[model samples]
Target: MTKDWLTTGETAKMLGVSRQHVVDLCTRGELTFSQPGTHRRIRSSEVQRLATSEFTREQEKSLWLHRALLGPLMLDPARVLQIATENIARWKPLQRGDGMATRYLEQWDEVIESGVDAVADVFTSKDERSSELRQNTPFAGVLDDDERRQVLQSFREHRQREHAAV
Candidate 1:
């Protein structure tokens, strides 16, 4: 059976540290553990949290940059366009790129002018054209497919609520 808790050695292996270090962490209460019988056990969740929490700022930055560079290649064009349009509409005036903001706003307007079918076309097409469109767009690469979809869905829901209140 799969275990929810890890033994001290298992936790050490997962964290890339020695068993003694894991023992020390458990002893110091830096890592929470349970003494079930004679052995110490660490919760798998706690190990995951500590591993993620221990990243340096530079490491985090490098990881995000790498994800951004790779993210767009995995996204659908329609989703990307919808995300871009929503983001542009919601962008604050104080943000950088006044000229670029106006241009993006104009593009958003044009997309709306073209109607839902044009947007639907983007969803249906899985061609190189769609990939090319995604590649040309800045900020499209910043979020991985799952993160982008979640953010876009959040924005879409927020916009629907705003429209409903009007």
Candidate 2:
């Protein structure tokens, strides 16, 4: 039997996002929560339904872009990690915690710190936050300008093919 309520962490795992992302959802009024005391308790039904949530067009694009980084990341995890942390450090002091970028970067930083698997999950997961996380990814310089152009062309062609089929 399933319980009616689940903690943010549980919901985050179920949603394949950071626990903080679940908290952020609650904070943004996107997910209602019951705070019995210290932590937020979300409705299991609400979270379950969100699993079927549609990935928007922008989210789809971001997913594909992140996919471009995945191969290099997997081939040389240590170097990619170094690059990501360096990128994060460069962006950190400037954030001042005023915008969504700051918060998402923090989440991505935590994932990067957790090691390759965690970071890989963010890039490859078919979950909602993966797309959102990519928007604020600290994976700059993972690919060079030429690589970026190639990826952009491939993505454009893929989309064009999709549109043609539809």
Candidate 3:
């Protein structure tokens, strides 16, 4: 069976922190870990939770934006659209005052309401076009291009793993 628990080093890598930090978190009971035969092992779920919780509000918003934009490509289209809609709604207020951003969100709302084909069209668009879409998104000003790319790549990898398990 695949191991579901991560060693301190592995957990540190996932959390982008040092091994000692992971140990400190475990010692402080901030992150759950178990000592099995003198080695501390953290559940992968705990690592994910910690990583997510560590994100700044802007990072979280960017994450949700990536999920909304890329999720339908790999998962149930309708479900992804619903998630995207909720994400957009949640961030809309914070995203006000930018005309391009407002227009982009409106476009997403229209596409989501237009049904599955519109969502698919977005997923199937050329890379250049997709990049353009990302540029116009609310997250564009929040996350730098490299950060956005990293977030999208990470989400894609996660979705691939999830699909492989299914």
Give TM-scores for every candidate, taking all chains together and pairing residue i with residue i.
Answer: 0.32, 0.65, 0.37
lDDT of 3 by residue, 1-166 (tens): 1379899999988776556657767886878888879999999999988776644333333344555555434566555566668767877777655554566678778776888776566544534334334434433333357756777777667667765896
- Candidate 3: lDDT of 52? 65
Query: CA lDDT of each candidate?
Result: 0.56, 0.80, 0.63
Candidate of highest TM-score = 2
What residue pairs are clashing in model 3?
none
lDDT of 2: 0.80
lDDT of 3: 0.63
lDDT of 1 by residue, 68-118 (tens): 434342455455556666665566354456453455455545653585555
lDDT of 3 at 56: 30
Model 2: how large is the Cα RMSD against the reference?
A: 7.8
Model 2 residue 154 lDDT score: 88
Better of 1 and 3 by lDDT: 3
- Which residue runs does candidate 2 get wrong by more than 4 Å? 1-53
lDDT per residue as tens, model 2, 1-166: 1499999889988877777667767886768789988978988888876767565445566678788888998899999889988888889888767766678878888898898888888887876567778867898899999998888888889889987897
The candidate that achieves the highest lDDT relative to the unseen native structure? 2
